[model samples]
Target: MPIRSEWKLAREGWTLDTTTRLLKATAFNPLITLPLILAAKYTARGAQVASQNETLFRTLKSLVALGVLGSISGFLDDKVVNNWKGDEWDWKKEVVVVTGGSDGIGKSIVLLLAEKGIKVAVLDVQPLTYEAPPSVQFFQCDLGSKEAIEATAASVRSSLGDPTVLINNAGVARGKSILDSTEKDIRLTFNVNALSHYFLAHQFLPSMIQRNHGMVVTVASLAAYLSAPNMVDYASSKAAALTFHEGLAAELATQYKADKVRTIIMCQGYTRTALFEGFAGKSLYPETVAEEIVKAVLKGRSAHLVVPESSWGIVPRVRSWPLWMQYGFRKGLKNLMKSWKGRQVVQPSETQVEKEKKGVEESAVLVEEH
Candidate 1:
């Protein structure tokens, strides 16, 4: 995955006065840095501060304290979203189709669904080597392409019948800072992570609407709500997908009068999975937890799941904090984001055979060795 950096340096064109206003009003702005910030504002702040010797030592001390606090808060907020501990999944009589089910969260979801005697279709570009249960079937498709998805959808319907549950879990994690990413990277992320849901839902949803029942589950990320350095394309694409999911749920209830078409989302945190790299050593949570969460949601619950079963509460409110705190916390999170580079891009065309041959490795060893 490539990095996207165009937005990071696009120059906001704000005047010195405007930037000064922002600095002064941000929460907990220290008196020591206010004048320096005001004088320098956007363009000249760095040079102006470098030349200033008038700031009191105590005030500088306060600014340093603020930096430490911000970093701590950012990390706390990031870790707060993973606290999802849940009950067992009852998957009797359910019909589910999971895209990108070759491995990772998608694979886990299929495995658990099969365990519960649910009929599951695993859609992927790779041929499956994982033994499917008597109730599980694998369908190969390039989910990023509309034509391919539509063709595959027809085959699935003809072979296994229309699925009552659609899990849009096919995703490629691109950890490149935006500037380093190719246009192809950006397009593939949006197509698979954002737009592919629309394609899949359209192909299978009419039957769901007619039957007065269906589940549409999407896997977004905690990054959608909080973006830092390194994952611009991946973060923003997930955000778009989240917004799309919200809008469609509203439409189903209002214009379409299809309240029976249940919509659920998983805004996952760090998990022990192959899609994420660079984050190898983090002890977040088992990926199996994510799979079970998917199963529980499929059984008839509307949910928002964050992995690791610990960070669930803090995630929703990470954005509601005052400006200074948000910036400081975000700055602190920069240190953590540096480790995001190891997450490999799991494209539709890439299989485990290719992954192993390409010499790509897991981001980190599993938190639980089984």
Candidate 2:
């Protein structure tokens, strides 16, 4: 059997993020540097006694200094980002709403939350793929419609109380060039992948602001940073989603005075799911992505996750590179989806305009009789 992508990520000393992980461990946890400091001192003493090797002594000393500096820099970064306040997690009282929770990464998140005895409301167009526990409740929803989202929000509030966590995990991808994609395809892609964030935020975020508590997790993709030839709509929406997450975090702190209300955006690499069924490159296991999301939620802190961790350095810095370099890199992605056997085109039951009108009519009575 072939080595699974998720397992491959965990390979010792060889994974994409292995070096990053080690550096992070050294930087964030000073204890990791203790051994390195000791080794430096030992090496310095040996070099002096054996050969008086100044180069060998200097190298070890430099490593020790770099380690210490990294640790301090990491500490300051954490404190500044979090505003020096720590998270106070109370999982028992929290209610989570996960969109697209019927299957794939969303399903895994639902199960994990349920296992922890958390109340989870699942909003998806499809039915649950597996039998859900009592803690999990499914709500059929077309995420592409703002009106549908409004109606569903009312249902969730009534059934599960106000949600404390909202995971915007539902998404649709139409692997087509700009010319090949119909207007409907483009609309549906943006509606679900990007616009729903606004609708959902309108419904639930006010409550979070009032209580000064909540979390919003946006599941974007690596494509958010790198645009491929066939994924124009997908990339654009994800980029919007990424910015939405950043702007939301800023607004929570600066505008709403709700620093405790955390925001997380996940820029995940390719994953093994219906979304990327025939993707040629290595794709992560959906469970792997879900585990990272759940873990971040449990910590009760704002985070920006670039999964496979190796892509962390490369993805975010793409735009900063030279024009030719950026062009060359994206040019390489032209054939990324040539083998794409995923949902090439998604046709929604109702058009966006119709859904909006119907949503308004259903949710609020238009002409009230006196």
Candidate 3:
């Protein structure tokens, strides 16, 4: 099927709102689909009516095609070609620890892992809204504090065995510009987003290093590349994370010579989480799925960069662009993310308090020297 611009928006709108179901009957409405689509009619009324008609026409075209071909061919071919029998991202045997697990993407992961019979631990100042498994222990630990992380590590070690996988998922969105941001906001941004990875690694990596097995997943964002104006704090922190993942992966493979200590860096787009509720759109693909993030974390791979396919070709590999295009390109991005009010997305204060408490907990955990 030809994915025209209007068609994509039409598809997304239909997917979001099922009220357009009657539009499916117009499957073969070629006359309705012709004007602005098949013919170049520049009038506003012609273009608007043509777009509305085109949407209905293409949607039915898709629904009818699915009824005819997709249901039978795709389903049966899948039965013969692929193994349907498989453990679907089983987290049962893994002791998965997720930071910022009380809210947003992190919270979703905690709930999902718990359902899989995984021994999961939730670390966040705030509690998870969703009910987790009985085995899923909730520890209020702040990732930003070394002291709190140490304390929480002790609690986690006592309650659960040495963690098999550590998800460095705790983060904050200081969606402020460099000029607008206060000093505290800047420090808190890096502390929560970037430095916490170090504290958690110190607590969890030794066990993985000793056993020569573990996965460390870092949740970064695509904003690291775009570096949109309003997200200066968020961007810089994520940029640190992306770079740190590469270096950490190299160190695990070269310095420690333990490739088994796998690492993953999740560079995601917008998700339908409380943290991003104010954000306009929800991403269906390319953005990291909370469930998929759990799966990737468990696979214990070396590296994973989740990017939309369209974004790959556009990434700036060369030093400069054609001069005429630079101004508009930069301006367009700012306009696209302009609704993103920086002040709305602030770091959670309880996150730091959790860190302080975790430090208290870590003092109780014992670490045997190599």
lDDT, each prediction: 0.66, 0.80, 0.63
Score every model by TM-score.
Answer: 0.66, 0.86, 0.65
Q: After superposition, how far is residue 78 of candidate 2 from its true place, in Å?
A: 2.7
User: Whole-model lDDT for model 1 versus the true structure?
Assistant: 0.66
**What's every prediction's RMSD, in angstroms?**
16.2, 7.2, 12.5
Query: In candidate 2, what residue range of length 10 has the lowest lDDT sum?
Result: 361-370
Residue 65 alpha-carbon offset, candidate 1, angstroms: 37
The global Cα lDDT (0 to 1) of model 3 is: 0.63
What TM-score, to 2 decimals, does candidate 1 have? Answer: 0.66
Runs off by more than 4 Å, candidate 2: 1-14, 22-53, 344-370
Off by over 4 Å in 1: 1-93, 308-310, 341-370
Clashes of 2: 0
Task: Show where candidate 3 strays beyond 4 Å.
Answer: 1-92, 280-288, 307-309, 315-328, 341-370
Measured by TM-score, how close is model 2 to the native structure?
0.86
Q: Would you list the rank order by lDDT, best first?
A: 2, 1, 3
Please tell me which model should have the higher lDDT, number 1 or number 3: 1
Per-residue lDDT over 188-301 for candidate 3, one digit per residue giving the tens place of the 0 to 100 score: 779888998988888889888786777788888876665666676787898898888878877876688665677777777675554443454455432235655766565545
